[model samples]
Target: MSQPADYRDPRSLRSRERIIRALRAELRAGRSLTIAAVTGEAKVTRQTFYNNFDSLEEAGWFALLEDFNTLLVDDIQTRWSGASPDFVGLASLRKIVELLRAESSLSLLANGYRDEAGLTGLAAVMLSEIRRFRAEFGDPASPLAQEEDLYTATGLCGLLTVAATGDASSTSIARAAYALLPEWMRQPRL
Candidate 1:
């Protein structure tokens, strides 16, 4: 399974870490990401950055996804206990917002460069984890269940990108996301 970007050698790992840190700093400063700019900021050779990542966006997205896998996915899996779908969906959305807040650079990269940074790839990672969650904690997912999961995963990526870039508060974004949850997952009114 693809966890984080792991390296066998300490030197390579250190180089990659420096590159990611530099990417984050560039993003925080609202600088355009380019190989030359990143390498200069990282104080690494262009070849060193290339050895670690194909592009500046790739490095940013990879770091973001790694954190998502470690922080959100693991936490969700740990919390699963056949809870109602509404509970799971809302909790997951809230956690995503919290994750983005904690990692401002990742949020900026994801939001500012949504298409370039490959948010769809992030959604795919989320889908796989959602599939795993269903397999372990609930009944075998039906076609409808799978569809719901796909929508939830993709929708969140788009919604989160908007939340990061727009004026919407995180709580407001969460509320809107909750309201838009798949009907099947929503609780019935009293």
Candidate 2:
């Protein structure tokens, strides 16, 4: 019989964590990412790195996705717990834009130059989170339903893209996202 995958193996977990930490450090330093840098930083051979991840982009993607999810959840809990109905949605939007702008790993992942597969995976996670939010809070029908979600996702993606290129201003990005709120939410309150 074939053996099941062993994600709990200490060596495997350590290797994965090392790779994630290396990627995070590289991104924070604003250094150009390469397989050589990752392997060297993680103290692993090229073959070892490849065994843990398909490519450098995949390594970066995993790190960024984890950071993004954690930050999103934490920011929501901290900033929106007792906010007024209208302010809640806008505050969430601003927080997202600000978070994306500040997180270099996310900015790198969303840039157009990264692996398309990784980018698509990140997009899927973002969409899933938004759906979960709607389900939990009640999805009041907005005239811009699909458009609003897509636009918000795309705008956040764009914000990260610009930040990766070193052209984004956090204040401006947050303002733009907040500005879209009135039209994105359902009228007559719910």
Candidate 3:
């Protein structure tokens, strides 16, 4: 008989969580984060850290993405529940920009990924959340069309790219995003 797929063990999960916690702690301490620093903080050997993650960059990206997703989703849902359907798109984008401003780690993660995987993943999550918000709105008059998705995704990708580059302050980015809100959503036709 074929063997069943092995699931992640509790210990492995615990170790990974510990590593993430340690990395965040180091970052919070205003210390330059390195693999050695994280391993030391986690009380794990370099080999163990490597065995769990291919590289510090990978771990950083995963941790930041996970954290931002949780925070962003919760904020979006709460805001959507209180706002009109017409407001969903801008509200969601504003929430994302706010998150990018508040969380410095997100910028780090975006900068860390040379490959498109991180950007693609971030875009996918944002797109999914926006779709959910639209569905919840249930406005046939303002349905989320393919073009809207494309525009929102591109705008978010641009924002993330700018944030990652660290060329401008998060406040400036947020303001720029807010300024573009009307054009981005541009209420769907009946």
Cand. 1 Cα-lDDT: 0.66
TM-score of each: 0.63, 0.62, 0.60
Q: Evaluated with TM-score, which candidate comes out highest? A: 1
Q: Which stretches of candidate 2 lie above 4 Å from their native place?
A: 1-11, 28-32, 45-48, 85-106, 109-125, 138-148, 163-169, 181-190
Clashing pairs in 3: none
**TM-score of predicted structure 3:** 0.60
Candidate 1: residue 132 Cα off by (Å): 5.3
Global lDDT of each model? Answer: 0.66, 0.58, 0.59
**Global CA lDDT of candidate 2, please?**
0.58
The C-alpha RMSD of each candidate to the native structure, in angstroms, is 5.5, 5.5, 6.2
The order of the candidates by lDDT, greatest first, is 1, 3, 2
- Candidate 1 regions exceeding 4 Å error are 1-7, 77-92, 98-122, 128-148, 179-190
- Positional deviation of residue 123's Cα in model 1 after best superposition, in angstroms: 2.9
Clash numbers, per candidate: 0, 0, 0
**Per-residue CA lDDT of candidate 3, range 1-190, in tens?**
1111322777666777788889888877878778899999999888767767766666766665676567557655655456553455445445556666565664555346433433444565555554554454424245556557546756766776566456665555655655554342434222
